[model samples]
Target chain A: MSDANEAANEPIAVIRTPISLDYHYSAGQSASRFLRAIAQGKLLGQKCPVDGRVYFPSRGACPQHGVTFGDEVVELSDKGTVVTFSIVRVPSENIPLELPYITINVLLDGADTILIHVLDAKLEDVRMGMRVQAVWKPKEEWTTSTANILYFRPIDEPDASYDSYKEHI
Target chain B: MSPTLEKALTAPHKLEYTYKRSLGPVLSPFFTALRDRRILGVKRRDGRVMVPPKEYDPDTSESLDELVEVSDEGVVTSWSWVATPRRQQPLDRPFAYALVKLDGADTAFLHVVDAGDEGNMETGMRVKARWADETTGMITDFVFVPA
Candidate 1:
């Protein structure tokens, strides 16, 4: 072998094989049940009597209260504000949104935590506190999946100001 | 129970991961040196130059300070062999996974080798990197060739 002065160059890599777990483990069917509700154009939120708001894809437990919730399903207003957002450039498995799609944390009316969903409005026009409504696919096209409701976008009318929803963020 | 169920072969289920780690600061220099066909180690608090350069002292947890260059040659300090592999392993064929301590480094590092058969591998045998042609910054980028 040669010294640092004469050694032939070689390369090495630190690869990241990032992974995410899906319902295949313990809750795929449960998640599907929640997804089915969204496809029907209704907003379903789970109530954790003591713990309060947990919306969609089934909130089996209230992380804050640490109590299990078993109650009647209820619907909330579909309208919400973009509490925060991120545009994912990298794609992963099971992601329905295309590149440059807006993934926003929407605080639906009456829910404590925000629900992550695709934003349907154009990237340039998107602003914080902009009021958006969930646009559901036609009744025939609905599926038991969140992708069933295309994405949230600005409602046809006026938008909300930053001050109105700043605290919610 | 049933004839159809009896016909179904049931073998062990397994999930294996052949992780390629980017050694970052400390191990990065060593791997790059390997690609450049050189060997290097980092000098640690105990004055020992550990190969596959460690970034922090295992005992004190302080950042490793200096980079030390070593000979590509080393002795096989320890080893494990795969008679068969599950998935993502470097080779589809049988091979030995060994810990080699290059000449100037005090610690050893892991890599694979096609040392033919189990009878041919020895704890003290010398070896060198059989570097890949289009090397990526990864350990699989090399297979050990007899030195």
Candidate 2:
């Protein structure tokens, strides 16, 4: 709303709407199969033929080219390398994250695009391109979100240099 | 249609968002200042300093770093009357909210103006910040009063 026409402006989008319009309980069907595997102690990603790069958290269509991929739903390695990161000093609501946590964008061995996950390793030693792997909780603690993969950290692979991933930042 | 299928055919829908911001070195200074009870702004190329300062230049995307002080007292740059207030607004009763340029600052911010009735508040009305007795350094800590 404009302060110039401020006095005349009206509030919007507040009312008791109908069942059809009121609450959308679900989206039409999405990547339920990939998500289902996460609950069953596994991680799956889709591979795109056009770019020959695997996508974690499967996209129905290739994000860059828009071609649909169905044949290559495969389990991803627990090991990955941190491509970039940010240390969050403050906490946000319902984030399910511990404060002073570092969120790292990791490029897994099989996938082309990197995915973000919580970093559970020491805060000071955390660096970019440091090799890390998933630390899943005991079988009792799996659920809908990727939080199932407790954290990622350097697993001994040589660190990647800044020149290797300049565009990713 | 049976009553159960009718219920199954319909359910609830919700949209939610969690925006993650990467604080480039410039804006981190601003947020860190907020965490420390101080306010900050960036001096723009056009000589207009902006509050809640942005990291990149408004036009050229240059990294802006000149930090300046802004007074709690400011003029209403622009305003809109809330005849029917919405959820999360400061007041339940009808009110006037305005963008006021603070006394020592070059930019404007939105806040609640405590005018008894909607009829008295005007576009050019002057107001002052009424700080909360208890503050966590968030935007909600201030309510404006008629100056």
Candidate 3:
């Protein structure tokens, strides 16, 4: 390589280009019902006809049994136990949280599957089997999106026994 | 409720990212030349000049480093007309994406030609670089126009 041009001596420019794509997302049958229920401050789950296990925010079918769920909707408690969690230190443009925030896979009561959500608590305090409950935004601010549930916070109850949520992890 | 009768929920989503990248040794100088209204090509082992230069020779896999200045004016070797341009396209109106063999260059490079109408585009038409008002060392610094 020849050092011919004086422009080559200049510092390399770091280009910051923002690319954005806009599109409409359609929430089909089962998800429509789930989103509507959440807007009304309720958690709904569908029971798999074969296994009889309930799935929260159901996608209309059972992955394990390979069968579609019917009208058997189950109302669930917002309180859940953290089956697994991770502390995110890296910054992202979409996430409006501070550094070192905790994200958890929570196993809600009476549901077979887990719901992934943000956990607002001290990093050291976030652990497996930690008892937490959903903190929702005001009623007027409620929308058909999961963003209605701002985040989950720790409750005064004792941590659930490992055996209670062992299978989920 | 029947599945067909139920109105599905729809929401608008925007996926965005601001990618910060360093144009390495080869590309760094290429873009820098564009800022000064200059076009560059890399000299291959056979002395063939490739516009929009690559870091390595495509066929021989040799590391290409000789930067040669090429004329912005070129002849369109091949072209495909776009009836109605979509978002982020070089031209909002109708245009043609052409492989232009710039003067003094051996190979052709793909770029948009803002020819106003598709009928105005041809295989061997002459075109020149239409530089942007503010050049920030980016590929989008210029588009081609009928000269």
Which one is best on TM-score? 3
Ten residues in sequence with the least summed lDDT for candidate 1 chain A: A1-10
| Candidate 3 clashes between residue pairs 3 or more apart in a chain or in different chains | none
Ranking by DockQ: 3, 1, 2
Candidates' DockQ values?
0.18, 0.07, 0.54
lDDT of 1 by residue, B11-118 (tens): 233343433455567776776765566667788877888877778988788999598888767788888878896555778877899998888888788878678777
Best by DockQ: 3
Best-to-worst ranking by lDDT: 3, 1, 2
Candidate 2 residues A1-169, lDDT tens each?
A: 1122122222211212112233555321235556567879777888787977778877567888888765458688888778888899888755867678999998876767788888887888888878889888777888755668777766877887776655566
* lDDT tens digits by residue: candidate 3, A26-103: 998889988988999999999999989989887688989998886668999999999999999999987889998999
Measured by C-alpha RMSD in angstroms, how accurate is candidate 3? 3.9
Which CAPRI quality tier does the interface of model 3 achieve?
medium
Q: What is the C-alpha RMSD, rounded to one decimal, of candidate 1?
A: 8.4
True contacts kept of 2: 0.14
